[model samples]
Target: MRDDGRAILTPPARGIAHILPRDHPQRLVLNDEVHARPSEILEAPLKLSYLAVFAEGEQRADVWRRVQELAGRYGVDPAPDTANHYSANFGPFRIKCERHTEFLRLVFIVEDGRQPESFEEPALQAVPPEWLAALPGQLITAANVLLQHSDGDWPEPERIATQFFDGNALVGASIADGAAFAFTDFRIRADGFSRLLVMDHGMTPRQAGRTVQRLLEIDTYRILALLALPMAHVLAPFLAARERELAEVTRLLVEAKAPDEALLFDRLTRLEAEMESEQSRNHYRFSASVAYEALVDSRITELREERLAGLQTFREFLERRFLPAMETCRSSAASQESLSQRLTRVTQLLSTRVDITREAQTQDVLASMDRRAKLQLRLQETVEGLSIAAITYYIVGLVGYLAKGGSRAGLPIEVDLVMAASIPFVLVLTALALRHHRRKAARES
Candidate 1:
């Protein structure tokens, strides 16, 4: 018997295998084939499933309405919102919806026992071949419904092309765009597990419901990739913008010139501070993404290699693009510095010219004062000479009168002779006396 409580096969020649010994249990041959042909023995039908996922956005109510309409169109019983009973039945398949933070999940599952003949039937029957043909159209319609409900304000379709593998086989490609994407797995061997992936974008409730539906049907990896890709797309722009901003700041740092060393240092420091923050954010987000990928898939070696390649490319871009830009900025900054220096020199020259003009004006003032002082001194000397002459005249006149009176009093000499002689003597004597008296008065005063 197998571990699953199923009967095991033994070789016909060996007869029935016995129970194992107490120590080894080697006698019991564990059957590896007990569950190998589950489809043949289980009597469950193979059916196709569909799921739609939603995220928290402006279109929550619309998504719910559309999903409900889809359920009605497909004659599927919609699941209630209870925690335990979240699945609905459509033909041979079960559809489930679940809610998550900011998103909704949907899951679909089909039984493996029997192949249904018709999806149109109310009960279990083989899924009609036409349903497979119709699935693509239905998925498209669902996307259209979502778009319409959103008033055509859906995110622009960003096509992401990727390859998926089933075990070792390169199965097929996946193209995710806008609010829809599909995955086809060619490696599925059984009808129940065969290729088919369709997802619809919606608000959080609808997305959760759709994710739950999908989780019940498809492999978990597909869901993870789907969810992660959109997130990565959103983050890519932010990351790129940060990279650009950092590059610009670095350029500014290299180009900055300080007329004063202190100012330059301050600018450079500020730029470096901002750059550090930008780089930190960039590295943290990128590394965190890499770590997340590592956790999602154990094949870290390839991811590491890719990361290294990306880093190398980034370095190359920095060297090729950023370096040149920085050089240009440096040149500009140098030009500015040269201009500033020239301006400073011109200002100094102007200041010197002004000082020279002021000095010339001061010299003119001093020269005028010196001339005035000399003129005043000469005037004082002339006044002194004139005063002496005036006193000499007055004394000479007094002498003439005295000589005339001497002639009248004495009878012996000629009056004219005496007057002439006496006048000369008197003039000399009077001049000396006046000079002495002026000197004495000047001393006393």
Candidate 2:
């Protein structure tokens, strides 16, 4: 059992092992996650450098491959690819690589018994430049950190800023409950690197290391969070134009006919695709920025910073500049989400209208078919009546010829009367027979 009342992870007691459930596939990994990327114990009078490489997309494997190659040259054992962090001793300087979601953090530490002039002799001076050049991904953040022991008195922020930061305004504070003091201008100098100066005052190596790590983390996360700002600026006008287009589409859809609705639906579908494409491009970046910003805030809080004289503190500096930019990113992302929802609603409404239009057209066609069928039936009935009359006239003419033949043979005189009597009978019989045949055909049909 551990001091925190949690049982230490180990094999179950021998007697109980047989009854215990099998371990989960990820048990060890999950248990050790909290211990990943631990801060290395650090001493004062140290030259430290941090590099954050923006490993965008699927670059983690490549980054690891390069790191492993570098390790081989230095005769250090390579870390497993699954490791979240790696550290090794390399003669003059020590290095640590920490893997994060979108960026890889490389920290170099060197013993600085004789602190050189500011960043002129940084920890990176010991690293192979060719190796660094070959490393994948672009550098997103870089900083030179100097940790010096406080002997007599604390240095003035303005003086330190002038000497190290080229007279730029500084922001820092006494941190770790006055165990140390930190100052930085947070400006990239001509050498393309920012600087942080820390003076340790009676701090244990662990506390000093934690303080430095937090400071670097704050710097890294702050910059990372601001990365979304540029995209937000570019997206603002696009969103406005899209909103206008959506409004126009809606207005045109109100009274659209069937063919017009089809055209409008096609247009709306294209617009929706554009919106989804934009969202796909920006969504992850925006969300990651928010997460990075939150990390920055959390690390700042953990620093336990106190005012160093009347100088601006790290929190104040970032709040003044960083937070507003982060908020703009959030607002832009929110606007995009809202706009996407609006587009979906409009598309759904358009689809429903199109469906209704198709249904109405189908109903109209069905009604027309019914009307045509009625007209055809009426015409057939008229034709049947004319056919029956024609048949009756022809049959009566034949009967008259037969009666005239009989009179000529002297079997029956009065041919006109006989033909006249046959007329009524023929007419009645023809009418009845035609009506019966029509009824039979109607039943069969």
Candidate 3:
């Protein structure tokens, strides 16, 4: 405050937010990501129906539009297209939906005062049958969770197992430090839904919600991880055939002659093409399997499960059943990489062999040409010598005629002697003239 008794205002302290520019395009999204798909705070004696659908990319819009339609039915504003997750309450039930990279999961929850008389009547009964039937995509996962807080006289695990899981051996665990007990047969029932019974012993609503969410994720990812198994199985036999073919190709490569090399190269090319096709088709599924498997492990660890007396924990069950399937997938992927590398090496080797053969053929052709050129040069020299001799002979004959005419006119000496005398001189002059012409021509060239 100033001495004049007027209230004095201090300037606001500087903040980084004030200094920084407006948010980047994804700033808000990245900030909101951690809060996405938060677990619902679930109360006891609730029935939850969950479904996971695997769909093509084009079909996803239809699913989202359907979600908007459902929201309209409930008189709630629809989720925007950019939203990857949403939840809202209708009068009879609450719905939560999440969009994933390859699948869409929708969960319906119904609050109730008491447990349902029979587990068969799930919360999905409240959802419109038409909507359920018209859900766009193949149903990959479906489960019904009956969550109830335990009362006095806790039911035996075997009783709860037989009652809820249709007499299958129960895999039970006390999770979250015995705050809850979970039971499941891990078997799909006739109604195409697996059952989970969560006896919430003393967990808060949030803890129970998280527990149930984890259970559902564990199941969903378990199925997703196992999806790679069948693909691996199919590829296994194909890979074996490729291996055999590659072996034969390698053997032929070692001993193949010029004529056979081309055919062998063609075979190798076709084999590599087929292997690449398989890899392209199955690569995503295999990689997704590994990712989903890891997610399952993470969720199980978060469960912090303590073994139930006389029953296997979730991790143990996975080690015995799920791990083997995942390992098969890993092994298949490894085999593909190994085979691809071997094929590449063999291809390089074959290319080198072809190049070397072509080089040898070119060298032979060059050597043959050199030999032919030398022979042609010798023939040309012989022709030139014969031509020179002919010219010299004609010149000497002309000199002889001149000498004869001179002698006939009684000029000097005998014609034959004079002609013989001029023979050597004519030959010498002709040879000198030819040599001079050759030198001039060579200089001009």
Q: Which stretches of candidate 2 lie over 4 Å from their true place?
A: 1-12, 56-59, 112-117, 152-155, 253-263, 394-445
Model 1 C-alpha lDDT per residue in residues 247-338, reported as the tens digit of each score:
55445535543333345344435544543454444434343433433333432121121111112321233345334433443343333344
lDDT for every model?
0.40, 0.88, 0.88
Off-target runs (Cα >4 Å) in candidate 1 are: 1-43, 52-54, 58-61, 67-85, 90-93, 108-113, 116-445
In order of appearance, the predictions have TM-scores of 0.28, 0.85, 0.87
What tens digits encode model 2's per-residue C-alpha lDDT throughout 152-257?
5876877787788888888989889988898898888777789999988888998888888999999888888888999999999999999999999989988777
**By TM-score, is 1 or 2 better?**
2
Q: What's the lDDT for residue 147 in model 3?
A: 91
Mind sharing the TM-score for model 1? 0.28
TM-score, ranked from best to worst = 3, 2, 1
Name the 10 consecutive residues with the lowest summed lDDT in model 1.
137-146
Model 2, position 102: C-alpha lDDT score: 84
Candidate 2 colliding pairs: none
**What lDDT would candidate 1 get against the real structure?**
0.40
Predicted structure 1: clash tally: 36
The worst-scoring run of ten residues by lDDT in candidate 2 lies at: 112-121
lDDT of 1 at 6: 97
Per-residue lDDT value at 294 in model 1? 38
| Model 3 bad stretches (over 4 Å) | 1-16, 21-24, 152-155, 390-445
